[model samples]
Target: MARQTQALARICDVISRHAQEGRAPTALPRVRLERVSALTPPAGETLGPSVSLVVQGTVRTVLCEKTSYYGAGEFVVASVGLPVTCAVTGANKVQPYLAISISLQPAIVSEMLLAAPAPRQTTVSSVAQALATGIADPDLLDVVERLTRLLDRPADAAGLQPLYERELLWRLITGKHGQTVRQIGLPDSHLSQLSHAISWIRTHYDQPFSVEELAARASMSVTSFHRHFRAITQMTPLQYQKHLRLHEARTRLLAHADDVAGVGYAVGYGSPSQFSREYRRMFGAPPRNDAAHLRETSAT
Candidate 1:
């Protein structure tokens, strides 16, 4: 326990020094450090295959109707890309929110699984959730600490980083959320199959698509596709697409606080009135009003 606490402290120190006001991509491979000094409003983001470990504060993430809160010494893993609303729930000037996120590559996971010994009977829950939270055990924290140390030694990073990453992946694969992490590397896993349709919707969010079309893309029957897609994302395909559109629209509106109708049409809403109504419903304000508020918030 002492060692784990020490490791976490070391990680917090490094992240505190390097993290920016928001997300900061680091020189280390696939690692991102985040720092937030104050509480933040919920924001939508599409989180890809990655594991994020909290080193200093707490975070709240909501996927559809499910809400998950994880604090320091805990980690969240997303086996597939998920559109989630996340906020920094615990932070202050004295104790800022800090976290490290590492992208998980399927190829490396597959290689490790193949080289690993034959499987033991699964211990995690049978029900699969694409996003999950787990307490970081001592082994996992140790591997993460070693990886973070690499940030200070760039010369050694290229040579030693892969080894550390492999070890980290191995630890996670055998940890409590192993079932969800393992699905990332399995081509035939339900998560993998769901990813195909998800990728399409994410890319062509502005385009109209039928359920049958998406089902075929995922290589599953329409009925099965609906079941699996909703199971992982906790939303129907239409709902996911709508969320993406609104999120994108919000971002665009924030960048340029003009063109409410144009932005609405650009994101695939056929009518300006419908767009305004839905935007108000989702964001609690009309498009123009929301955009202005967002811009004001950023300026301050």
Candidate 2:
């Protein structure tokens, strides 16, 4: 038997070092490495369209009501950009959690699909949510293992990263998770439409919009849009907008810890008291207190 091309153990250590550098990319045009040494409490994060592989340890992420578990040798594919609550479910000093995520650019995926002579047909017909997890195949592991090696070589990464990243996506296109990933590129697909609606909401989060407007934009009936939107995102459109506003408020608060009321108003809060109540509800602390704590944490 031939030796395995991808050594999972070595790959884990490589990403661990990258994460330790304190330079984790929030989104990547190509490939990105992420590592976490200690288990952490669940926190909300907005993720782009991507596929993530667990090289070591474990991670648990909850999107809406759906909770996904990824252990070593497993993969989690976020079919579209989504707001999720995530945390390290398992890790230790001996084996820190290491993961690598690659952004799935729709244009690149479409171009690759067109250039291919025969794209493999996806076997999955069931509707997929924002995130799905599946066991990693050996071929995916091999290609991704090769991709990670480029992180250490700047010259090679510039030239060959695209090729390997394409290969990694190709594997997902043909693998069991192919259907879920394919949905992102299907222009008229339900997931794609929801993505469009999500983009609209995020852009105009400060402004009030109605369900009829969103439904029309997505080319979906009011009932259908409402049902599917909640099903896919685990929240109603209004709820999604609230979270988006709250997330933006939090971001702004990190910079101006003193402007709690201004931050709330800027994020679309008409009532300062309502803002404080909701802020406290979501963040587990009032706006001023939370911002102060965050500032204190950064200083120390």
Best by lDDT: 1
- Tens-digit lDDT track of model 2 for 125-228: 34656666787777877887777877667677767878888898788776666666777777877888878788999889899998999998888999999988
Q: Quote model 2's TM-score.
A: 0.83
TM-scores for the candidates: 0.93, 0.83
Global Cα lDDT for candidate 1: 0.87
Please report the TM-score between candidate 1 and the true structure: 0.93
Candidate 1 segments whose C-alpha is farther than 4 A from its true place: 117-127
Give the per-residue lDDT digits (tens) of candidate 1, residues 219-262. 99999989888877889999899889988898888776689888
What lDDT would candidate 2 get against the real structure?
A: 0.75
| CA lDDT of each prediction against the hidden true structure | 0.87, 0.75
